[model samples]
Target: FLPLRGILPDMICDSKSYIDLLTIYQEKARKDCELVGNYLYDLLQKYCSKNVSSKAQLDDLVSIYCKNSSFLNVVRTSELKQEYRHENNESLKQYVEQLPAAQQAPSDGDQSESMMTPQPIFAQDCPELCWYIGLRLCDLFHEKYGRYPGEQLKDIQNGSEDDNSREEMDTDQRQIETDLHDLKLIGKQFLTDHELAKHQGGIRDTVLEELCRYGSCEIHSIAAFVGGCCAQEIIKLITHQYIPIDNTFIYNGIKQSTALFKF
Candidate 1:
């Protein structure tokens, strides 16, 4: 489960291994759900991201390859949304006193120059939030329609012999595209809709592009690495000892390389 994924991110972010993180993580995870504690062992093994009405039953599902476990055992969070906002906001506040003058915004109330802060509501570019949004879109589309975007994509490219099937596929393609368009509006609207993130915006288009590229594959090593990177940035923020990431970070596991971008 989803609940285990929530807790695992914290553990991964801390740079603790699966077995090593068991002690503290077990407690934190259990605190989230008693079923999580009961199923902690299996959850630590191979787990599925299936629908679970209850933690106990959710843990019971042995189907679906828990592919992420290796990365989890090696990789691997909550309402991903809530955890992300809280972590970013709390960490940024702690970093204010530590940042250099150039990094910090002027207190003179000048709106001419934009400001970037850890505050989720005030963040200029939060790839992490956008990342979650992309994943959410993937899940939403799949659940609403029985097929994935990728699958439909394949069907379209391959072409269907049956006119009815082909037409249906075209309809699916249009619907998915509409969903993507809605995602853009959702990102911008979310800021205005929720007074909390007012003007914050919904999500990023680049994030959406990435989700389309990757489709349903949930890469654990990548996720865990990102978690670690976030942890490091937050540490730098709290200690004010080092420069926190002023730009978004990108890692290419295929090439085993990393790059930073300022947007």
Candidate 2:
């Protein structure tokens, strides 16, 4: 939607001073186009029409734009390369030549640690609301029973038969109830009286209550579904250039009760 065409030529002229500027423009255009394609695909069902407007139409537009942009970048880069060649900029030519063949290997420790760390469900600036809820529920469980609920819930979700004792089952249920109580507390702290009344017995209310009372086992099946929805929304925000993302917001969900962070 933005008029990138007008600025492209000025930044991409065949000149030594503009080489870096040209590369930056090309990269930004490629990234912006990809983001647009992704956003359209994710929200197509909600906003697009089946008869006239469709994901396919959006995809086609993105493909055409990308193709043209890619061709233009190639041509521009080639021209720059030619200018360098003419000027006998052998150092720059050698650097370019080495780029395609050179590969960097991570240290052994780096590889091992990277493999062990779980991939974040959302972009670095995107908050994992469900996970935040889960962690808060875990803390509430710990307050009541002096132990985290994560281990027990993990066992149940993983279908581990070894921990199927009656005692464990009862403990798990109690933990869920405690989680539900916490959710109510959270809701009361955040929502106005009218807003809370509207959702008193609704699905959202029920889910929040259940999550607080019982932990993820009560909603483990929907964890991935909820996470994916949040990820989709976050992607839309980033791609649309909606706002500058903050890392702290991603780490901590909206704190309703206090202005200051407790931890």
Highest-TM-score candidate: 1
lDDT of 2 by residue, 32-120 (tens): 77777887676775665464465566767885666555334221123333432335434323322332321233234543232112222
lDDT of 1 by residue, 1-263 (tens): 44432234433444356656666766654454555445654554446436324544544342112322223321111233553353344432332223222223235554432111111121223334344445545565566566544443433444448887767656655654565575555444443333324223234554554444444555899889989999998897689555565544556554466654332
After superposition on all CA atoms, what RMSD does each candidate show versus the true structure?
A: 20.3, 24.3
Stretch of 10 with least lDDT, candidate 1: 113-122
Give candidate 1 misplaced runs (Cα > 4 Å): 1-133, 136-165, 193-202, 209-263
Clashes of each: 7, 7
Give the Cα error of residue 109 in candidate 2, in Å: 55
Question: What does candidate 2 score on TM?
Answer: 0.25
True-vs-predicted CA distance for residue 192, candidate 1, Å: 3.9
What local lDDT score does residue 58 receive in model 2, on the 0 to 100 scale?
Answer: 79
Cα lDDT listed for each candidate: 0.46, 0.43
